[model samples]
Target: MAVLNEEQEMLRDMAREWAVNESPVTEFRKVRASGEPEAFNRDAYATMAQMGWAGIIVPEAHGGSDFGYMSAGLVFEELGKTLTASPLLATTIAASAIALGGSEEQKARWLPKLASGEAIATLAVDEGAAHDPAAIETSVSGGKISGKKTFVHEAHGADLFVVAAKDGLYLVENGAGVTLTTRKLTDQRSHADVTFDGAAADKLAGGGDSLLDDVLDRARVLTAAEMLGMAQQVFDVTLEYLKQRVQFNQVLASFQALQHRMADLFADLAQMRSAVEAGLQAVDSGFGVARAATIAKAEANRVLHTISNQGIQLHGGIGMTDEYDVGFYLKRARVLEASWGSSSFLKDRYASLGGY
Candidate 1:
């Protein structure tokens, strides 16, 4: 078991308390009623910004807490329990891009805003199908980017877009030929089909074939961390439901078959945690982060998918009903599984890295 330090534990507790008190399931219910792609509570987001949660992974020079990936992952876990819709993941991933590849001036300009939550940015990489960075069909020419990015998360409200075009990675200002067609996804977060028609953009960095690879690898690891949190919550909720849900003149927890199922799920969760932690450590350890990230993501997808379905199954019909919150977990699990890359896609990547 990986132990968190006192400060890390405090941060996790703080995030858990805030998410439970402020952005509870009721808040999510309200957001669902609002018919918005990004279902986050605006006031809650502002509170998080004030608390510096948005900049947890950013450097101190950029108005951030300068916390590392492990610390940021702790906060993400708490946020996952609520399935709170925010741009934290997108912002953190984008910040890494700047930190790793951006010019000094670019970092000085964007990191502060990103860290301050004054700007929302998302990585635009997927053209369509197959999560191949090489399939990036978007083009850049004459300081302009033109292409369509599908399934862009939180893009409906993003102030900036870090686009991966064929010419290079470009940062295009919002509304500079950026047309957003919002998509209503199962998770109800703000996702859109973004079209850039000769959008003026500033080049961030270029010259490396592995730039997109590195970015996507970071995305996979971070996303796996989020999925781990979601799976943990699902397990907790299901366990509680089993204890209270009476059937056959006894609680469901008393059933031997269900007990065995829960045991299996516990093992799966433990394995997932190991995978995620390994990937997190790999990010800074100079290990093959690309391969580690793929394994982490694929394992997370499989475990979370199983956990979500089993949670619903264990909850009986109530799990399928809108009144129950487990359905939301299932929906979010499906979306997260498909995003970044599917389980099969990541598995293939992992095998290829192994020279299979």
Candidate 2:
């Protein structure tokens, strides 16, 4: 675990409290039951914005705390524990893009609204089913962007989109020629196939050639933070279940084999946490971000996959039931594993970065 300062500690504790008390897994169940296209409570999002969580990376002049990515990761970790459904992650990633690449005029126009959560934004990078940023075919012509982005997160809820084009990144509002075709996934969250038919686009040209890679690195790291939380929760929940569940007149946790399995999981969880925190810190320090983010997300994909599955197997028949919260974590974990990058994708990226 990262050694947090006083302010970071307070923020993490506050987020933990709110996630546990105000927005538990039951809240996600409510969102699932509502079946709203956005897949989250608007009021809950407003409350999060009011708490200043939406602007963790935005500059202070733009109505944000500018607390950095580490702080943002802390909040995300807590939210992940309870499977909180909100556009906070997508919006923050969009905001980071603008902060990194937008001009003064662009920042003035969008950052404040994004910081205050008055509007929502998300990144649209992949055109195919997999996470391949290099394969983006979206293009901008005559000040308009035209392409189809599949599986756009928070698409229905986005007021703006940081779209990836052949030349560079562009900012397009969710009006005019923009259209959304809903695509339901296992997670049942806000995702869509966004079609931009000659939608007006403003170029984000200031971030240089590496802007997209930088933004994606941030996405990978923050996402890894969330996965870290989920893995931790699954481990904790599974451990508690083992202590209570009895078989053959002995508690499951009392079995030496079961204990050994858990001990291995505990070590894997520790390694995942280390990589994730390093990724977050790298973003803040502006050092080795690509390498760190790759490692972070890869470890996250590896450990969370193991932990969520083990949680199900350890819980026996009850784990697969809808009544149990463990199943929900497993479902959510699968969705997130494919987001930004998968374990295989990250491994390839890591090897490429190392010049292997």
Candidate 3:
């Protein structure tokens, strides 16, 4: 486990308390039931911004706390526990792009709004069903960007888009020339295929050739943090369930076979936590980020898949029902697993990074 500083511990505790009391899984249920395309409560997002969560990675001069990636990961993990739905992650990823590659004018124009949650932003990359930044077909010409980005996260609520074109990243506001086709995935979160038909774009031209990869590393690490939280919650919930659920005239938790199964899950969860925390720390330290992020996300994909399945099996039939909260974790896990990179994708990338 990563040793947290005093402030980090406080932040983690506060997020945990708020997610449990203020925005529990029931809130996600409400959002899902509302059938809104945004799929998250606007007021809830405003509260998060007010709490300084929206700007954790933003520079202090730009109205953010500049707490770095690990701090942001802490909040993400807490929110993941209760399946809290918000655009915080998407916005943070976009903000990181600007902070890394945006011109001074670009920062002045967008970072403060992003930090204060006065504006919503998202990254538009990958124009396919799978994660593939290298295959981006989006292109910029005459200060306009034209192409489609499939499954853009938080698309419905975004006020700005940090888009990836063949040449580089660009900023496109949500207005004329930008069209959205809503996509409903398993998690029922806000997603859309965005068509940028000659949308005016401002290029971000400062982070050198590796800017996109750096931003993506941030996304992968932060996402793994969220998965860590979900895996932990599922393990906790399943363990508690086993203690109470009786089978064959004895408590299921007491069964040696079931105990061993849970023990295995516990070990996997521990490894996932380590990889995720190390990834977050690596981002903060600016050390071997690509390798660390790949390992973190790969571990997250592997462990969460197993734990979510085991959560269902240990609970027997009830785990599949909507009434059970464990089912929600599984649904959300599947979507996240496919988001930045799948296990196979990360493994290949890791090998390439190692020059194998």
Clashes of each: 3, 0, 0
* Regions of model 3 farther than 4 Å from truth: none
What lDDT score goes with residue 155 in model 1?
A: 90
Worst 10 residues of 3 by lDDT: 244-253
In the predicted model 2, the residue pairs found to clash are none
Where is the poorest 10-residue window by lDDT in model 2?
Answer: 136-145
Look at candidate 2 and tell me the lDDT of residue 199: 98
The weakest ten consecutive residues by lDDT in model 1 span 204-213
In order of appearance, the predictions have TM-scores of 0.96, 0.99, 0.99
TM-score preference between candidates 1 and 3, better one: 3
Candidate 3 matches the true fold with a TM-score of 0.99
How do the residues 280-341 of candidate 1 rate in per-residue lDDT, one tens digit apiece? Answer: 77886758788888888999999999999999999888889998999998999988998889
Against the true structure, candidate 1 reaches a TM-score of 0.96
lDDT for each candidate structure:
0.85, 0.95, 0.95
For model 2, residues 1-356, the per-residue Cα lDDT tens digits are: 78999999999999999999999999999999998999999899999999999999999998899999999999999999999999999999999999999999999999999989899999999999899999988888899899999999999999999999999999999999999999998888999999999999999988899999999999999999999999999999999999998899999999999999999999999999999999999999999999999999999999999999999999999999999999999998998999999989999999999998
Error of 3 at 155 (Å): 0.5
Q: What lDDT tens digits, residue by residue, belong to model 3 across residues 294-342?
A: 9999999999999999999999988899999999999999999998899
Clashes of 3: 0
Model 1 regions lying over 4 Å from their true place: none
